[model samples]
Target chain A: MSERSPKKTDTMTEAERDAYHAEKMKKKKAARDKILATKTEERGLVIVHTGRGKGKSTAAFGMVFRAIGHGFNVGIVQFVKGKWGTGERDVLEKFPEQVTIRAMGEGFTWDTQDRQRDLAAARSAWDAAKAMIADETYKLVLLDELNICLRYDYLPLDEVVETLRNKPRDTHVIVTGRNAKDELIEIADLVTEMTEIKHPFRAGVKAQAGIEF
Target chain B: MSERSPKKTDTMTEAERDAYHAEKMKKKKAARDKILATKTEERGLVIVHTGRGKGKSTAAFGMVFRAIGHGFNVGIVQFVKGKWGTGERDVLEKFPEQVTIRAMGEGFTWDTQDRQRDLAAARSAWDAAKAMIADETYKLVLLDELNICLRYDYLPLDEVVETLRNKPRDTHVIVTGRNAKDELIEIADLVTEMTEIKHPFRAGVKAQAGIEF
Candidate 1:
């Protein structure tokens, strides 16, 4: 798609280039305008970010920043991250008026090695998640590491899908983690897989404070 | 990997669950600490976000938010997304002391249709990017949509890679866009390709505020 554009030329003067460029852009704009006219629907999305690479949660946090920028109320439920004192959490805590965060996790399953406790934690987080999604006051809800819970059947996948299917019309729900289930994917409006191209951890580089947390 | 963990069961009492969880967590912590002991290197990273999916810029902005929370000075240079008054821009502008945003794009290449203008804009943005990377005061520098410029040959790939390769040791450099150059990837400590599994645009859903902006 990028290669379709004409390459730079040294022979043309600045003024000449400007006129030619303007003409081409005009035609492109007309085509773009036609496409814009066809897009009339505006509804909240069921967004899923998954795969082996990073940024699944990071991107959702980015959406949180944008939502905060727009003065929209946001709710965050870290399903398994717990209270690691993440930088994002610290920053989010500063915006109490616009944000409501519930770090309702008791570490990973392997870390806890207790079934009832894991189920209790997942149920607690899911309850919080359902409340936030059902709440009309919030515009965005982020469920971090929800996929892992579903993958382990900590929470019923059908219940999660049903809740998302019947969410408030204008409330966006973002779920992030690796190995997202297929049923969730089928029901999602947007799904992105963050494929790992290169990773610093394999090179023995430790995670930094601001970047990783 | 999440599947390897044991599932929830109803038989265990709360006290038993706690004891088991504590014992397992202790062993897991010991193993984690041993691995962590080997990771001694700490320095700035050359991070690249590229692919055909959403959140390349969004995730970088998430990092920007985290950096800001940590009170790290940040610099942002938009190579192609000129000011249409993005939500993130509005938020970043509020923190004047910590962020320096330079929006030098002249719209999309098709919109401008001018090679010289594109080249000039790229040069200006690259100048700002290099300065931010070289400056010790800034801890993180985000070059948004820089991959598009490099893919189009608007900026010199070798020069950009060279600049990043020789950047200050403590300043993190994040370049985001689709189709990143191989040279940049070759030197980058982290690379993520955001693969598109499903997109709302395909369903004729227009971009909404606080989500797509």
Candidate 2:
């Protein structure tokens, strides 16, 4: 065997190690204080839900219910899907002022033959979303099916990111849809991937009310 | 001459109503067909970053980044904190897979404090959150605070919703922090709550890291 030289290890000196440890300790203390101080200040929560998997909107609705239970005002703006046999419309409509709902009735891209109308509706929705973000009237804001708009070129991704980045310090925003872009993910504090493994559709089933709808 | 009550207008018969509706056709037939044919098809989205908030889980990171660029996953789950201090954390320690991050931490509650440990430790993080709710293996789940043990009597309210509720049909889960509960919001699909709100403490502030330890 060709004589392989012994591997070398980089070791820190005592002084270097001590300094490093001290720095780490400092960071730890800072973090602890931050956690302690966080109890008093108000901040924003941003959510982005997207993927080929099912139940994205359903998940959002669950959070909405939880937030409401905790006494929070919520706002939902449906980007591409407006009218259909959706259970969300039925249930949310019945809620008190604790929740506000808005939708773009143009439906999906292929349905809205007029490109201008789709773009205009998206712009209008964006304007409303901007207002909500600025006003802080609602504790939570849900942008339902918004990712589709970004993917379909209905709304500029840049503007969406900019708005979210500068949104009110206390209002929470949730963006949901498939084909989420990378730019939006960069600015976000958390990210998740929903990879489709198995689906009931492959077995030939139908969308049912109160479950799939 | 007195004001008369308004007369009832003519009402449409069943046949008339059917006729009126018969003329109105759905605009996007093919898309509707596609949507109708697949029972388990994914259409829409939701972000659930339900996990421990402090000690740097960054539940919303992956989702926010994905929305900013093309080809990114989107989701979030802030399980614990209901308050602030994540802004700086969001600015740092970003991962490509994270899209959106939202955390809710309000420090530790004392009355129910453990006699064994005074400060929080990462190793014991999972203990506080209700298992099914804080499990972050989903596309998004951010158990923010959750450190109350049954002995502490900090967790309660209702049965855990379960991972099936808010979790994406396909994704990873993100569980953070201490005492997970029974009524843990298990069917969460996504779930999170602040465990340390209104924590008893002195007025002057100084957060130490590693051990408050």
TM-score of 2: 0.46
For candidate 1, the docking band is medium
Clashing pairs in 1: A21-B113
Query: In candidate 2, what are the lDDT values of residues B118-205, reduced to their tens digit?
Result: 2233224333333433444423333443323221323323222333244444443433344444334332323333222111133232
Structural similarity to truth (TM-score) of each candidate: 0.88, 0.46
Q: Write the per-residue lDDT of candidate 2 for residues A32-70, one digit (tens) a residue.
A: 767777545335656565566544564565556545545
- CA deviation > 4 Å runs, candidate 1: A1-31, A83-85, A105-110, B1-34, B83-85, B105-109
Per residue, candidate 1 scores C-alpha lDDT tens digits across B109-148 of 5566776777888888899888888898998999998998
What local lDDT does model 2 show for residue A74?
85
Q: Candidate 1 overall Cα lDDT vs. reference?
A: 0.85
Worst 10 residues of 1 chain B by lDDT: B1-10
lDDT of each: 0.85, 0.48
- Candidate 2 wrongly placed segments (more than 4 Å): A1-42, A83-85, A107-109, B1-213
Instruction: Give DockQ: model 2.
Output: 0.06
